[model samples]
Target: MDFYLVFTIFIFAGALIGSGLSFYVEYTKLEALESYFSENKVVCDNKRFWGRNTHIDRFYRMLLISQLLAMPKTHIKRGDVTEAELAAIPLSLKRWALWPINFGFIWFASIIIWNVWYR
Candidate 1:
């Protein structure tokens, strides 16, 4: 019974994290949209969400920041992306939109395996 309880707890926590990530991705997309308008000077900065620093901003920025930090430091190339440009690809462009899907599967599989086999 206790093992089942623990398994359920883990699954619930994982699901919560996954849902939060989904929200973060949406927030990132909104921020990206804000940037696009800002570039054209069509939307004032005040109209953007929390001045583009919403609480969900960190992880979304992580994707861009990490990619920039991973690039080479040398040899100038005309088409090569600069650190700032690389750090601004917009989360809406990433294929990781389905990241939380894995969490749901893992949660279900954990419950099934633990309850049916371990318990």
Candidate 2:
């Protein structure tokens, strides 16, 4: 295979692998969070449940602040879950889903530049 083609394929394959791994990590976290909420009987607003942060928040923060984030504002307002409740969450591995995506763009840009500069 041509060198450029080989490199492009490798880049795309890496992106695919990274994306798959990130998705699995995120799915696991979501399941864990949902179970935790159901057990604790915490109710979150629909907006909170479906927000951008809910979908794409980093895994490290997710592990730490998930309990706080899962709680509704009413609970906080009613003094059910305190700001100090926010302090006790454990630390864990950070899920990074964007590495492949960022690299994909870099690869694309490099390919374009290579073509232009070489031709």
Candidate 3:
């Protein structure tokens, strides 16, 4: 196969895996995260804004948690997440919430780069 075709296939597989992991986190761990952050007004308000669509709500929640894990200081300064609350979260949960989103972001950027470079 051509190198571009092979690389594109790899990117597609990575994106699929990232999406699946994202879905898994949303289904299994999202509720716990929601409860933990229930008192955070910013998170609650965003959740409420996406309340009309459960899928979007869950996706947003995943993204929020990922952001919270990736940049605790920023969210802390913004009052979106507290340090104590962030410390209380399990490391495994944090990893689960973080990696897939990171992978998705990388995968997206790769696709954009590939298109721009190869087109």
Report how far off residue 119 is in candidate 2 (Å): 7.3
Candidate 1 stretches greater than 4 Å from native:
30-95, 114-119
After superposition, which runs of candidate 3 have C-alpha atoms over 4 Å from their true positions? none
Please estimate how well model 1 matches the true structure, expressed as its whole-model Cα lDDT: 0.50
- The pairs that clash in candidate 2 are none
- TM-score on alpha carbons, each prediction: 0.38, 0.38, 0.86
Candidate 3 to truth, TM? 0.86
Q: Tell me the tens digit of each residue's lDDT in model 1 across 50-115.
A: 345555554454333233334425311433344454345555443343454455567778768867
Listed per model in order, the count of residue pairs whose N, CA or C atoms clash below 3 Å is: 0, 0, 0
**Candidate 3 residues 1-119, lDDT tens each?**
78888888888888788878888888898888778787888778878877764777789867777788899998888877889888888888778778787788799899898898696
Lowest-lDDT window of 10 residues in candidate 2? 88-97
What are the lDDT figures for the candidates, one per model?
A: 0.50, 0.50, 0.82
Best by TM-score: 3
Given candidate 3, what's the lDDT at residue 114?
A: 84
